[model samples]
Target chain A: MDRNGLEKQCLEVRRLIVKSVYEAGSGHPGGSLSGVELLTTLFENFLKFDPKNPKSDSRDYFILSKGHCAPLLYSIMAFKGYFPVEELKTLRKLGSRLQGHPDALKLPGIEVSTGSLGQGFGVAAGIALSLKIDKKVNKVYALLGDGELQEGTVWETAMAASHFKLDNFCAVIDSNKFQIDGSVETVMGVEPIKQKFESFGWECVQINGHDLKQVDEAYQAFLSHKSGKPFLIVADTLKGKGVSFMENTEKFHGKAPSPEEFEKAMIELGEKAL
Target chain B: MKKYLALREIYGQKLVELGKNDENIFVMDADLSGSTRTVLFKNQFPDRHFNMGIAECNMLLFAAGAAISGKTVFASSFAMFETGRAWEIIRNTIAHDNLNVKIVSTHAGISVGEDGYSHQANEDIALMRAIPNMQVLCPADALETGAMIEYAAETKGPMYIRLSRETFPVLFQEESYSFTPNQAKVLKDGKDVTLIACGRMVDFALEASHKLEDEKISVRVLNASSIKPMDSEAIIESARKTKLIITCEEHSIIGGLGSAVIELLSDSYPVKVIRMGLKDVFGQSGKPQELFKFYELSTEDIIKTVKENLQ
Candidate 1:
């Protein structure tokens, strides 16, 4: 799809994110909105996945290391037709396949079950290492929150990925600044991310996460890099990207929009409010 | 003197044999490859072996990742770090997803000797047994360790195999010994009292039974190797016949074999029971034999417990 087409899909995903969280009555919206374009562009342009055969051996793997952003992941997977878009309403409900966190066993296309932060990144490294050992060309990708970077395990994975020379692995940090407590900088600064990753032997790049074009280019660089080094995309994003009231704020980091707020978000995305 | 063999050494050798037969077998260690003996597997299949540095949490999650991708991953470390430090990772990532990751940890219990309380995993069996979809196995000797590893490889889902740092007396013959999960091995049978033990303590229990034999104090020794699916049938039968039971393990008395047996019998056939292990205390630096005696887990302790319970 072209840039215009991808931009349209991102808007649709944002609307879905608002609607699902509103329907669920309690869910995260800030980080979910921020990750809209990064995931939308990859699923549409790069990721080698067949929604029908989610467990196919030939497919590339994607893990949401920052699993609190399940709203965003569920929206993209639904848009990609992994399951009915309507089923997303059941998210976080009792007996729902779309758990509050991504449950790989219950939901197809979720390559790993992750919620307690920094775990999915390590799992992604393991998958990439397994692929390299088997001489398979399937790529492994994981999306992490800047807050999630505080977890010691993330650094451990970063070190292992580089030491083992997992060229097949790529990790994108959604540097949205805000976490539930407050901005990541104030909470526990994880700045100098690019330098840290580079020193660990990973080829690093900084990108505007919300810009579809830059997200595409970052993924492109990862696919083309011939250096036997893991790739890190330090994506700078807002805590909440789309809605006016929620943008760059910690309030919506985990709070669902009120009925009045939900209608406003839908209207802002150019959709008719329910 | 009884012949003693290192369980970790046998584990390393068995992994190489399993790796040769199955191309998908992968081994991971957390910088303790030399001590855990995964160095043996590493020497054989360098491509399939991963030395995951000193990070235990990342190693377990990595093992879960490889397992989910259709590989049977055998991850090793000292039991304290493997089962204690990375416990939440094992539960949330590996056990919750029911991945094919076999955590074969060495240096379990006070047998870790000189390493002291921080290194000893006296609560590993209890911790592992509580997790859903996790199978906990403790091998009594070299032969049982090999058989349990083989069984874990063939079986699907998450499993934890506990191995001791101290060499144990070889009790099972290689040709005849086979591991069946949840089935207790009847080492010897008597009507007066039942002595149930797992891991290194099984040897002590057997010794106590022989000493009791001379005194006409008939004792039954049951090797309760599979701690989770714990041979409920055998425990109940022993309880019914003997009416007295003594449980032993080289672990905390709280959640290991003794607790498992009592938990079962109390619900089914409640009998006079005495549990022999570290009674809510941490182990200090000492020789394995000295630690066992200090912790009241020696053969003499078992014999005394049995004789007292019978009275």
Candidate 2:
């Protein structure tokens, strides 16, 4: 896929996310928009997933460690044919399989159940190690929020991964610079994320998360370099990338779009998105 | 009933045996290998053993993830650290998802000794049993513990087995003993009353039954170790036969074995239940026997409670 095509797909995903979250009435929009391009490229082109046989032994595993961005993941998975697009509207409702958090047990295409921050990487690392034990070559990909770096377990597992030299494991840090509370700088100060990961013995790559070619090239670049260490791609992203009103805005961190504001947000993410 | 074996030892042996038989079985620990007895498994099957340093949450989450992808995983750690510190990971990754993870925690109950309140896991059973689709087991002796460990490993979905640091006597005959998961064991027969207990308290219940027998009070003794399922059949039948119940354990009265028995029998059979356990108080550093006695989990306490309930 070319740069413009990837960019257009990312924008279309953002539009779908906005529309779904708006219809659902109670879904995360801020972090979802922030990670638009990163998720788009990974699920669209990078990941080796067969949606029809989601738990195929040969298929690559994708775990959203930053699971609060369920709306974004659900939108992408629905587009990828894991479930019906209509099920997106029932998110957060009592009987909806689309729970407030990502439940892998109830939903297909979700490799692990996640929502609690920092814990996802530990689970992802295990999956990677298990694949190694099985002598399987399927790569393990985990996408995490930068603010989630505040968790101590992330570093513990990071050090363990480095110590194990799990080159098959790949992690993407969506550096949206904002948490549920405020700016990442103010809330937990996980800056120099690339340096931190590198210090833990990971071969690090820093790139603009909005740039699809850069993201794909970086992922491919990391994959090619079998340096006996895991890869951590620190993608610099806006908190709310696509929508003008929500970009880098701390207020939308967890707030669901109101009924009145939903149309305008949808209009911005309409058929002709950025 | 003097010479006893710690359940952790039994779990460690069982893990090594299972690991040797199945290459897919991976054992993950959180640096407390000495206490949890996972070191035995590690030494036996070095290739499949993973030590995650002092990170309990990582150990648990990693185990669940490994289980999801074809590894029959057993995660071992000290109960206090695993249940007290890494609760969220166990809640979300293992139990909430209902993953095929057998979580075995040693140093359970006040019998963990000198470790004091911070190290002893007095509430792990309650913490794990509350989760949906989760099985809770606390075996009384090494024989029962061994059987429970095998049952947990073979069973599907998530399971939490609370093992002990304090070794109680191996009371049952291994040749004749069999543990049915989620089923209560009816050890002794009586018509006047039923004495239900689990883990360390099983010995006390048996002793109390003997003491009461001398007093001409025929009290039935039950090893209701499966805390979550609570052995409704045994509880119901015993309740019908005896019309009174006396439950004991080495945990809190609020959510441990005593509470479980009451919860099971509240609707139909509202019999009088005398609970003998730590009276909603934290434990302090002391000898295992001293602590057990102080918490009223001793044979004397059980006997007294049984007599009081009979009246």
Candidate 3:
């Protein structure tokens, strides 16, 4: 799809995130909304996953290292026909496969269970290593939050991925600046993120995350990376990309939109809540 | 009985055998391959081994990823770091997903000796057992450790096998000895009292049983190697037959074999139980035997406890 068509689909996902969080009365809408385009583009364009057979051998794998953004992952998977789109409304509800965090056992496309920060990245690297060892050509992708980078395990995984020369692995940091408490820099600075990954021997790329074309180019560079190194894309993103009130706001990081606020969010995204 | 054999040595040797036979078997260690004895597999199958370089947390997650991707994975580190430091990662990724990953940790319990309290993993059993769907195994000696490595690879889902650093007398040197998950091996048969033990402490329990026989107090000994899915039927039968039970291990008395025995009996059939091991305290720098004596895990301690708690 072109950039314009991708943007429309991104808005649809953003609307789904808002509606699910609103119905569940709890979720990280801010971070979930920020990662819409990143996840949207990957699932729609780059990811080679089978909706019929989620665990097929000839398919690629993706892990959500910043697992609190389950709303976005579930929305994308549901929209892609992995499951019924109506299941998105059951987010965080009791006895639902759409858990608060991605559960690999409960859901098919989820390759790793990653509620704890920095863990999924290592798992992603492990899958990449396995694919390399098996001589398979499947690419492994992982999404990490800017605040989640504060975890030491993330750096450990970064160093290991590059040391192993996992060219099949690509990690993108949803650098949305804000965490639950405040700005990621004020809380715990992880600036010079690209240089950090570069020093770790990864091919680093920086792009405006909200721009679909830039996101596509970043993945393109990732695909072309064959300098005997892993790939890292540091995409600068807004905390809330689509909805006006929630953007760049920390209060919406983990709060569910009220019924009235949900109506406004749906209206802004050109959708109606059921 | 043959001279004592280091559990880690047998573990390392069995890993090589397992690796040679199954190409799907992969080994990982956190720069402690030499100490954990995963170096044997690393030497044999260099490409199949991953030296994770002192990163236990990431090593576990990596193992989970590989195991889920259809590889039989064995990850090793000291019990303290592998089970204590990276417990949540193990719980979330391996246990929650029910992935086929075997976390066989070495240097468990105060048997870590001169490394002192910091290196000892006194609470590893408790930490592993608390996780839902995790199978906890503690091999009694070198023979059982070898058998367990084979069984662990064959058995599916998340499993933890705890091994000690110090070499102890071989208990399962008999030709008929076989290791089975959740099954207690009755090493001695008597009726006055039943002695239940796991890990290296099983040898001490056998010693205690013989010494008690001289005093005309017959004792039955059960090697409770499978800690998590405990041999509850055997425990319940022993509770009924002997009417008194004594549990021993190298771990803390609070949550090791003793706790498992008491927990089972309290639910099914209650009996008078005496728990023996480290008494809720950290160990100091000492030789393995000296620490065992200091912590009252020696055979003399078991004999003493048996005498005191006997009917």
Candidate 4:
């Protein structure tokens, strides 16, 4: 699809993020709304998965290391025909298939269970390593939170991926500035992120996360990478991109909007309020 | 009549044989392949072996990734790193998903001599047993170690098998012995008192029973190897029959074999139970035998504890 069509899909995903988190009455809207375009670009263009046969051995795998952004993944996967789009309403409810965290056992189209910080990144690297052992050319991709990088396991697995030269593996740091308490820098600085991955023997790319054209081109370059090193894309993103009231603030990092605030967010996202 | 063998050596040899028969068997080590004896499998099947460097947490999750994708993966390291350091990763990825990964950890307990308390893993049994759907196994001798390895491969879901670094006297004959999961093997039987032990401490229990026999005190020695889904019926029956019970192991008495036995009998049939092993103390740097003696886990310690409790 072209840039105009992909941008439309991103708008729909952002609208769904506001609706789902508002209905559930608790979630991280900041990260979920911020990851809309990256999730749209990956699922719509790059990821190789059959919604019906999610357990297919040959399909490309994706892991959400910042799993609190489950809304972006769930909405995009529903659009890809993984499940009925209407079922997205039951998210975080009792007996709902959409768990608060992505549980691979309960939900289809999810490659692995991921909720704890920095764990899914390691799992994705391992999956990439397994593919190399089997001599399969399939790729593994993961989206990590900038705040989640504070976890030591992330760096450990990062070193393992480079040491093994997992060229088929690719990761994107959703470099949204705000975390739970405040800015990622003030809470615990993880600056020089690009140089860190480069020093670890990874080919690094910087991109405008909200721009669909840049997101598409970065992934295209990742596919053609021949450096025998894993790829890391540090995409600069807004913590709350579509919703004006919540934009660039830590207050909405984990808070659900009120009914009146939900109306304004739906209007800003160009969707009808309930 | 008896041969001494290192459990790690037997595990290394059995793994190589198991790998030859099953192409899907993958071995991962956290740079401890040489000590854990996974190096044997690495030498034979270089393509299937993965040296995950010194990252035990990532190695376990990596093994889970392989296991979920139709592979029987064995991840190895010292007990401290495998169970202590990477416990949450094991619980969430391996145990929660119920993946078919065999976490075989060696150098357990004070048997990891000269490495000090940091290298010893006395709390691994407690740590693993607390997780849901995790099966914990501690084999008594070399024969049982090989059998348990094969059994773990055949069984589905996650398993934690503990092995010691020091050599232990073989208690079972090669052709005659068999392993049944969650079942206790009655090595010897008598009526006066019951002696239950696991891992390297089983040999001491046997020797202690022989020394007690001269005093006309008949002792029953049961090899309680399976720790998690323990032999509750055997323990309850022994409690009813003998009325006196003594539990032994090379690990801490707080949460090892002794704790399992007491937990079982206290509910069903309460009896006078004496636990003989390391108390609430970490092991120090010493030879395996010297450490065992210092911790009061030798044959003399077992005999002394039993005789004191018998009166």
How close is every model to the real structure, measured as TM-score? 0.98, 0.97, 0.99, 0.97
Candidate 4 chain B lowest-lDDT run of ten: B61-70
lDDT of 1 by residue, A1-274 (tens): 8999999999999999999999999888999999988889888999999999999989999999999899999999998889999998998899999999999889989988999999999999999998998899999999999999999999999999999999999999999999999988899999999999999899999999988889999999999999999999999998879899999889998889999999898999998897
For candidate 2, write residues B26-118 as lDDT tens digits: 888988888788899889888788998888888887887798887888888888888879888888788877788888898888988897999
- How well is each residue in A1-274 modelled by candidate 4, as lDDT tens digits? 7788998999999988888888889988999988888889998899888888998977998999898988888888888898888988898999988888888989988878888888889988888888888889888999998999999998988899999899999999999988999999999999888999999999999989999989998899999999999999999999989999899999899888999999999988887797
Better of 1 and 4 by lDDT: 1
Tens-digit lDDT track of model 3 for B1-311: 45889899999999999888899998999999999999999999999999999899999988988986899999999999999999999988889989899999999998899999999999899999989999999988888899999999998989999998889787765678877778998899999999899988898999989998999999999988999998888999999999999999898988877888888999999999998888899888899989989999899998888888763
Error of 1 at A95 (Å): 1.0
lDDT of each: 0.92, 0.85, 0.91, 0.90
The ten-residue window of minimal lDDT in model 3 chain A covers: A265-274
- When candidate 4 is compared with the true two-chain complex, its DockQ is 0.67
Q: Write the per-residue lDDT of candidate 3 for residues A1-274, one digit (tens) a residue.
A: 7888898899889988998899899988999999988889998889999989998998899999999999999999998898999888789989999899998878888988888988999999999998899999999999999999999999889989998999999999999999999999899999999999999999999999998999999998988877879999899999988889999989899999888888898889987766
Taking the candidates in order, what DockQ does each have? Answer: 0.82, 0.80, 0.83, 0.67
Best model number under DockQ: 3
TM-score of chain B of each: 0.98, 0.97, 0.98, 0.98
Candidate 1: residue pairs that collide: none
lDDT tens per residue, model 2, A90-133 = 88888888988899878988888889998789888988888887
DockQ ranking, best first: 3, 1, 2, 4
